[model samples]
Target: MNQHVIRPVRADEWEKVKELRLAALRDPAAPVAFLETEEAAVGRPDAFWQERTEGASHGRSARQFIAEAPDGTWNANVVVLVEEAGTVGIFDEAIDVDQGHLVGVFVRPEQRGSGLTEALFEAALEWSWSLEGPALDRVRLFVHEDNARAAAFYRRFGFEVSGLVVPMPTDPSAKELEYVFPRPAAN
Candidate 1:
């Protein structure tokens, strides 16, 4: 079980965020699990990470959550981006509903099966469904078809295939399947 704290990344933690991301990019699953390459992430400037951290830390539309070990290491992380209905999606398509899109999911190899990823996701979903003004309609994630381990975990976590598929940005011949956790029915 994971006893570590799961919380949003702070504005000043860009270096730690970068470190965790780089480590994640080196994981064996990274090739199919992430859209960006380690080489690309390593080449980004400090300013890019700083700005990205700042935005995620304070922005209303996006947040990055981390599972921090007692020793202060970030063991896992997940980022959620709010897509407003009628807005352009990250893929440049139209977003038909207000929703949260999970991305940049990673868990350190040592933390695998230790419940850290679930803790990270609970924090993310709690944050997502709690957003006010105009509440989100659902939270969705895309998994590479080849990443069966990830997709199976997502199913166990309550996300269901949304019957939509899109070409992976890195390989047009490969596909990414959409899964969603719609806002829980009103209690």
Candidate 2:
């Protein structure tokens, strides 16, 4: 049995981050589950990976959590990006509140059914709700309509359809549905 530990990535772990991201892009569901391609990711310079890892690891506005196997290999990851009101997002949607946008979610095939996904999201959501400045009102993620596995997982995790649809940037004919987990009401 492999012991898996869930935690945030360190800023200096850029090499590992790059390695895991490449692996994710190679997964069969990459087409609909991820926004980047293996070809593009592999072509990126080391500086880009370094900057990306640094920002996500140390930046207050975003964070990346990874599941480390007993042998020290990262087999899964999830990232949350904080968006403030009036900002334009990657998909051209205008942010209407202080929200956390979940993205870059991936888990290795061997680790898929081991509750790793749930652990990763719990960490991401914990960090999002714990942000001190400009408290978040909700957390959101867009799932490709054809990716039923991912959609089912999100639904099982308490995310509900937000009724906002956006055309896939790479394939305008395809659509992605938005799902949201609203913050619980104050006691």
Candidate 3:
């Protein structure tokens, strides 16, 4: 729904955060769209979810945004993690430039094809580019190569493949392709 509010997740909403994640992991496309399974997430201690929510809830290094229905339900979420130049990143690889990596992407099945994903990215990109003290160069995401639907959406959203391939952690034979939203030129 267009009325759905898009905003950053708050520190105190860990329970809601965990709830949405579990739902996301249970989606049929979850296997390719998410790294964690529902079973694994369900077994994690509450503290882990709390700490995770708290960390991303308030920080320049990471931010998680959600689309909340008017009824107070969180139907979708995405996290943008900052990767500073020359620092180690989530991929356990060296970072070449400052950037924002979008991860933990999820949209409720009922909410798909509603333009909600674009709204979420609009918020994320707005935040990413608005950061000061040496702004980031670009925003990027990795999509599983086998997930054709997602890859198509990313392309339609203006994210171009950067020619980088990441080996899947669970199945090295599979791969993830990097896509980036090019930085806007100075106005």
Ranking by lDDT: 2, 1, 3
Q: Give per-candidate clash totals.
A: 0, 0, 0
Candidate 1 — what's its lDDT? 0.92
Q: What are the TM-scores, per candidate, against the unseen true structure?
A: 0.97, 0.97, 0.97
TM-score of 2: 0.97
Tens digits of per-residue lDDT, candidate 2, 1-187, equal: 2578989999999999999999999999999998899999999999999999999996678899999988899999999999999999879998999999999999999888889999999999999988877899999999999999999999999999999999999999999999999987878
The alpha-carbon deviation from the true structure for residue 150 of candidate 3, after best TM-score superposition, in angstroms, is: 0.9
**lDDT digits (tens) for residues 1-187 of candidate 1:** 5569999999999999999999999999998889899999999999999999998997678999999888898889999999999998655667999999999999988889999888889999999999987899999999999999999999999999998888888898998899999999887
Q: List the residue pairs that clash in candidate 3.
A: none
**Reference-based lDDT, residue 21, model 3:** 94
Off by over 4 Å in 1: none
Q: Which ranking of candidates, highest TM-score first?
A: 2, 1, 3
